[model samples]
Target: MTRLLIKNGAFITMDEEQLQFQGWMAIEGSRIAGLGAGAAPEQEISQASEIMDGKGMLFMPGLVNTHGHAAMSLLRGMADDLALQEWLQNHMWPAEAKFTGDDVYWGSSLAAAEMIKSGTTTFVDMYDHMHRVAEVTEQSGLRASLTRGVIGLCSEEEQKTKLAEAIQFARDWHGAAEGRINVMISPHAPYTCPPDYILKFVEAAHDLDLPMHTHMSETLAEVEQNVRDYGYRPVEHLDRLGMFSRPTLLAHAVHLKDEEIALLAERKVAVSHNPVSNLKLASGVARVPELLQAGVTVSLGTDSAASNNNLDLFQEITMAALLHKGVSGDPTVIPAAEALRMGTVYGARSIGHGGVTGQLKAGLKADFIAISLNKPHFVPYTDYISHLAYTARGSDVAHVWVDGRQLLRHGQLLTLDEERILAEAERCYQRLRG
Candidate 1:
């Protein structure tokens, strides 16, 4: 097995107790073999052909973007400052209709470059043409869970065909790319998918043992529509159809009611909180602290660059930590350490990789990021946890690893051509505009 060692860094594991120290993590093949303070295991260290000196840097589990449309990087900033309906109907959907496999590949590749540089090793993506997105993720050496965003506004036959395509894609690519990629079934949203269609998806997911990803109550307008049409809230309608019983990931759960929150907690539903996207689109803020207190697993996400304007999980983490407190009028709502957990370990849990890839522990996947704390903003590191949550930026990430492979080293992307990807994305965007 190929071995690697990361030594002498201030390690923040984001474990149950939030452990921190200057330590070494040993990687044997794609798994973390051991981690501790001071010295590495001699056998593991000796076997390492590559060593990463982590002095003046903070090593933690890589950020997990729990929800996003990776290919939407091609449409980023195209329809900003608009309501969600207008953004999607008038701008995004029309632009997406022009997307080809090549567009998905190039756009997803660009998104991968941006995410890796920003210290996100794992992301959950919902988009069309995900085969191209999967190929891009494989080539970039990033871990991902991908879903084909299924909108069932068409006929039942067309919906079945798309669902079959999504299922086939999952069967062929789930656990592919050296086990760095997984697959999920995504129903776009309640407004887009009728209850019967969602139930069909739920049954299919149950049959295939795949997780379901979907948007729920992203906006008040959406909630009002659901109420007007279905006579119940979004989550209530989903619960009525028994969609919440499955291993479900709910995105942008902004307008959830108290009863819906309880339902989520009871069903152990996972939520992806996209703070920046919510704020940008004028969507209401998610009750993250309430959800957390309700025993719901709340993870952090950037949604998509098109909606969020950037795929920076660090910024999301900071926003998630501060937004709830300010909105709830409580200073002790979400602590810095807890916010970090939402981005790292909790995110992994949301995507069904809980014990495997979230933390830097033995038997976990060696997927982590290193942020340089030697900068002015990170100076006087009186509290390492505080520095990580508040002081560190995406630019401070000097290294990133996924599945024991070095994808980013010393602020450089090893698997992607940054300039080419960006230029190709720009070209595609111009074509879409034209």
Candidate 2:
């Protein structure tokens, strides 16, 4: 087991309560074994096999992307400035049909490079060709929860085949790669999935004890369509089908009624709020304040680089804070500290890794990043929490570590071949254009 020590840093542990600043963190094997403000433990200190200086760095738990189509990095800017339906049907889905396993591998590798450079250590991904995505994630040394996005609008036999594929992927990959990869069953959405199919997926999830990930109420059109077709809103329909009885992570959730919010809280469904994607698509802001007040666990996500234009959780954190405040007309809606939590600890919890990661406490996984604070934007920083949430950018990430393995050091990625990945992605893009 590799033992490493990161010493003399301004630690910003986004723990359950708030940030713990100016501390040292130690990693033994793949877990965090020590973290505190004073001197390192003498016994463990002497036994460390390696030590790295963390001066002029703000160390915090790595950002968790609660929801994303990571391989969609290949389609970024190809379908921008469009509504959700137009973007998906005309651009994203069409291009996705041209994707081969190699395309997925290269595209996902590119996404992983961007993520590691931007300090995202773990991500929850839903897309097609997930085996390729899994391969990329494993090789990149990033932790991930992967799912094959299934559209249940197809024939029953097709649905069964897709479901079986997803189950097999889960069985083969979950807890694999030194416990770095987890898998989930993902039904595309309510509009795409019939009630019977949704019920079937839920049953499968229950049988396998796997958590469910899906899109829900991302736009008013989706909700209105659900009501017109089923005489119930999206959440109401899913709840009636017992979809929320299991551990479920819902993406978007931008248009929900008060009753739907209550139901989400009642069932303890986790929500992944994609503020940047929602804003870019003209989707209305989610009722995050209401959801939080109702006791629902809400986390931040970038959705995909195609719609969000980037995979920076710092931007999502700031947007989540300000969007809710402006939408609700309350200044205290989501404070900076709370916004940071939504991106870190709350995000880990939403993806079902809260107990194992998300904090700098002892016995947790050593998944964290070091932000360079020598920049002009972070000057005269009195409160590290506020500065991090309000001023930090992805470019400010100096180093990133996942499971005690340094994936990025001094803004250079150690796990990916960037030029080769970019060239392969460009070739795929040209093929799509043809």
Question: How many residue pairs collide in each prediction?
Answer: 0, 0
When superposed on Cα atoms, how far off is each prediction in RMSD?
A: 1.3, 1.3
Candidate 1's C-alpha lDDT?
A: 0.90
Give the poorly placed runs of model 1, Cα more than 4 Å off: 41-44
What are the per-residue Cα lDDT tens digits for candidate 1 across 1-434? 88778888789998866499887988888899888888766776778888878888889999999999999998887889988999999999988999999999998998999999999999999998889999999999999999988999999899989888888888989999988889998889999998888888888788888988999999999999999999998988888887877889999999977988998999889999999999999998998988999999999999889999999899998998889889989989899999999999999999889999889888999999888887899888899888878777788998898988889988888999988998998898888789
Q: Please give, for residues 1-434, the per-residue lDDT of candidate 2 as tens digits.
A: 77888888898887655356665778997889888886667775787889887888899999999999988888889988899999988888888888888778878888899889888999999988899999999999999999998998789899999989888888889998999999998899999998888888889889889999999999899989999999999888988888888899999898887888888988989999999999999988998988888999999999889999999888999998888888778999899988988998898999888888888888999999999999988999788888888889899999999998899989988888888888988888788778
Per-model lDDT:
0.90, 0.89
What residue pairs are clashing in model 1?
A: none
Give the Å shift of residue 292 in candidate 1: 0.3
Clashes of 2: 0
